[model samples]
Target: MGLRRKLLVSIGLILAILLVLLYLATSVILMSSFSNLEEQLVLQDVNRALRVLETEVLELNRLLRDWAAWDETYAFIETGHPSYVAQNLDDAVFANLRLNLMIFVRYPDQILYSKAFDPQGNRPAEIPRGLYAYLTPESALFNLPHPDSSVAGILPLPEGPLLVAAQPVLTSRYQGPVHGALIFGRFLSAAELARLSQMIHLNIDVRAYDDPSLPSDFQEVRSSLTREKPLVVQTPGANSVAGYALIADLLGRPALITRVVATRDIYYAGQAAQNYIFLSLLAIGLVFGEATLILMDRLVISRLSNLSTSVTRIRTSGDLTERMAESGKDE
Candidate 1:
């Protein structure tokens, strides 16, 4: 090949290899950046969910405290007036108290008098024993033991998965002596949990269990209930970043909240950025390759071609001085 052709071919090959390396490097960088961004977004989402949960727990606590301090509850329980208790368990009180259920677990006696209400203020029959026992005095109202006691933690039921909270019902007759205990609770409904999940844009399954034998709501996923970090599920492929987030809820029940994202979407986003970078590098390489071709054609190839012509002219005419006209100008 002629000198210009040879130089051009060498430059193109080297530039092509460099461009390929650059493309790979760009892809790696883009992948790292996109993965970091995705992780940040997911973390932010998880934080937002935690904040919402905190607020909900605070609000519910406030309402529960207010109900516990009510004088009507004290009088009803203290006087042992089931009739009066029934009357005060009105829809109006339930609405005003912002509680779905009113349960008075008579401590020491182990008798539970509870009333159920809908949002509109209509009182319903007490929930059946199987469901209500663990939630009330009958089951020891497990969570409300004295703060210093070992039994202060809430305990779950055997047959049905339930965590019971027992709060001591103090009597004013002896200037706030612990007369007995009271159980107040509302089941963590699937609908309520689903609402919480939607607020965080997560698909969550919540399970509460006191008994080891009972089937768990967490689909039998053997996980430490105490771990604070999220359990991660990873996606396949080097370019993909799909995963699942497992979050634990410890308030009403020990539950797991899971969030999932697809790897295909992550791969597409990263690939899109990488493709742009490759195109830009390709353009730069093309420009450099073309410029090198032009320089060699002008400075080196033209001179070599003129030298060849001049040698031929000198050889044919047997003249020492002979010149060849230079031809092209690169624009």
Candidate 2:
């Protein structure tokens, strides 16, 4: 090709190569940054869920301890009159607790009586016959996967694994060696789970098991923990993900495996990142485009023009050795 055409092609090639390199480099940097952002978002949600759970668990424990200390409990254990114990467990406490907290009395054979906080007051019920086989004659408190002689065990009901926080009831009024155990029961209800979800901005679920081979109840409490509040279902939605952590309550209930959900329909944050990448590319293109022009003008065009003038002068003087006077420059 001609000299001019060759020069034009060389410059175009150089520009094309520079642009492609920039796109590759920027894409790597942007992708890494996006991954880091996702990790940070997930970490934030997990921390939030943990905080709320800690607070709720603490409060529940406090309430249970308070109930155990009530005078009516002393009266019931002393007199064997459950009626007085039921009377003391009122709506005020249940409403304050936001749910019906039950206390069951376990006998040698089965749960002798289970008392719940009803709307009117305390309601008593007998333990299920199916679960009677799990009771014990022991005087000490025991956890689930109950011994054969174990008395009534506190269980999270409507079916989630039980949180059987049992304490042997002992008072000056009781005759036997620690008259049956006092069992505290609290279910992992939707509201309690929702509170956990809100704290983390993510959906929450829990499963408990002693043997990994056993099946479990996977109850979904909320939608997602992402800032966007995405949907959580059998299958995750677009822009959705899930994470989990295993925890065991203080009562030594079965290991509680907690699932934290993160999801959203729209890639609001990802789209924003992409837009930023595009803008950055545009700015870089402009800068390089301008730089290419300026360099061509100064190094190629201007310098060549000066070289031509020097050649013309030398030709006119007929002196082949006449060196060009260096312009206001060192070279």
Candidate 3:
């Protein structure tokens, strides 16, 4: 190939290789950095949502302590007072407290009173039939040996998931010959979840792990939730990323899955920055390469060609008078 064409091709090839290497390196380092940042932010948002739910459970337990230790509640559990239910278990109280079910039962099994309320409908509802299974002696609710020790945790029943607390009925002053346990339950219904999502200002989704039907994303996340990785992060699409965590029940079984999705603004911004820089460098390289080729042609290549032509003519025609063109500029 001619020198000019060869030079152009060589420079182009070199520039392309350099650009490719830069792109790969930038993607590996820059993209990885952005991905780690996005995962941390997503995890923080979702974990905050989870913390809000946990705080609700803790607050509900505190509320239970208030009622369970009251003088009226101490008498009502033993007497089976119709007056207590009439005076205390109003529909508004259930709706205000967001309570779905409450039961008064003695240790090892006697269920004295049970009430379930539909908060939305403002009416009495049938209690979860599986409620008793969680109240058995095997469970933490009725197995309390100390008045100071109370129970509060999640119960994933057939009807739905419940945030329940069981406290031993005692005097208002905290004195207890420990009568029966007062168990309170609230279903983690859609409305309740919505309220929690709004409170935390984060989009959160919860799915039952053992449910017969779960969303495709939930199933994928569930598989990733190994003992080593309780929290898994993923990019479901080009524009969005998500964080997933398992919610274990009181028995430490995988009961629910919580997911938090976020927009890929950080990643997209990094990619845009990379592209802009690569394009800018490409433009600069092209301009610089053109200038370099022109300089070489003028200062060295053109003069060398002229000198060769003059020498060839001198040798062929026996004319020793011809001279090569020379320039003052440095090659």
TM-score for each predicted model, relative to the true structure: 0.71, 0.62, 0.92
Top candidate on TM-score is: 3
Which 10-residue span in candidate 3 carries the lowest summed lDDT?
322-331
Scored by lDDT, model 3 comes in at 0.84
lDDT of 3 at 156: 80
Error of 2 at 205 (Å): 3.3
> Which pairs clash in model 3?
none
Task: Please count the clashing residue pairs in each candidate, in the order shown.
Answer: 3, 12, 0
Residue 215 lDDT in candidate 3? 77
Off by over 4 Å in 2: 2-4, 90-96, 99-101, 106-110, 116-158, 161-164, 170-178, 199-201, 207-237, 248-256, 263-271, 290-331
* RMSD (Å) per prediction: 5.8, 7.7, 2.1
What order do you get sorting by lDDT, best first?
3, 1, 2
Q: How would you encode candidate 2's per-residue C-alpha lDDT over 1-331 as one tens digit per residue?
A: 8444566667667766876777677667776676566656665665566566666655655555555445556457556685764575555655566544454464454555565543333443343332333344433343322222232223433345343445455443432344445665445656667766776567876655343433322334222222243222222445665554545444334345566666642245655666687677767776776677677767676667789889999999999988976655545
Better-scoring candidate (lDDT), 2 or 3: 3
Residue 317 lDDT, candidate 3, scale 0-100 = 89
Residue 147 accuracy (lDDT) in model 1: 28
